[model samples]
Target: MGAAITRAQIVEVADRLFYEQGFEATSFADIAAAVRLSRGNFYYHFRTKDDLLGAVIALRLANTEAMLDGWEGATPDPVERIRSFVRILIMNRARIMLYGCPVGTLCDELSKLRHVAKDDAAKLFMLFRRWLSLQFAALGREADADALALHALMRSQGIATLATAFQDEGFIQREVEDLLAWVEAQRPHQDRPTSETRPQP
Candidate 1:
């Protein structure tokens, strides 16, 4: 395989390892073993552990962009788009419970270690913040767009932290329901989408 392909493979596995085993805990050997790449080959692509971190952060940022874009295409209503964000906790509840939100945990780890790529990992959160702010702006809450977006982000981070700490899926479900209610409340009466139970305009 070409160098580019090998590098991509290493980053992909490193992303997962960092999320699961933690960035500081995951060794080059662990990543190499996972990809079945020889140490020499792995070293050829990533000279230092931080080099692997840089690639992993870039990979995560690209994936986050694609995911946020997918949600944008999934619906026209900004409220529903925001709902999609809330739904991520439900979708990844298992992993969130284990790893306490991949992006959040990584940023925390790198921050503690004073890793150079800390801000890069933080870009993952930045992507969500910007996307959520746009959706709130579309909802005509421009004044509170950033506040609203950050509110949702904070709630999710809190939930992920609690779920991971307590290992409670029930708490996740309850919090998700509450977050969805908050999203529903943000929609204006005229632009609100109706379900079967709700009266149509």
Candidate 2:
């Protein structure tokens, strides 16, 4: 593969390994082996795990921005936009059950380790928070948009942590339903999507 392709493969593999095994537990050798690259080759791209961690965070940030943009483009209704955020729990329930929230888990782990990239990793949550806040603001909740955004973000993290601990798909589904209900409650009654209009779970 070309150098750019090889570098992208390394970052992608490292991101998965970091999410699945964790930043501290996963080592250079693990990532190099996963990408089938020698130590010298891996070092050519990343001399330290921290460098790789930064790349991984950058990758996530870009991916998340694209996702948020997609949601914004998918609908003009802010309520439905918020619903799109909530439904991610249902859509990624299986992965959440296995690994917890990738962003949450990585942030928590990095925090515990006092890793320098902890704040950088947390930018992922900040991205979601800002996006959700905008959706809330669009829904006429500008006065407490950030607060409402944090509420949804906090609940999703709590659900993901518990889902991973309990390994219960039903719990995920139930919590997702509750979350969607909460989103609906945030909407002004006059602007609420009707039963026939709301997307099914």
For each candidate, the alpha-carbon lDDT, in order, equals 0.90, 0.91
Where does the lowest 10-residue lDDT sum fall in candidate 1?
A: 192-201
lDDT (tens digit, per residue) of candidate 2 on 12-31: 99999999998899999999
For each of the candidates, the C-alpha root-mean-square deviation to the true structure, in angstroms, is: 2.9, 3.0
In candidate 2, position 184 carries an lDDT of 81
Give the backbone clash total of model 2.
0
- The backbone clash count of each candidate, in order, is 0, 0
Candidate 1 lDDT over residue span 1-201, tens digit each: 888988888899999999999988999999999999999988988999988888888888898899999999989889889999999899999999888899899999999999878888888999999999999999998999999999999999999999999999999999999888888877767666565234322
lDDT for position 21 in model 1: 96
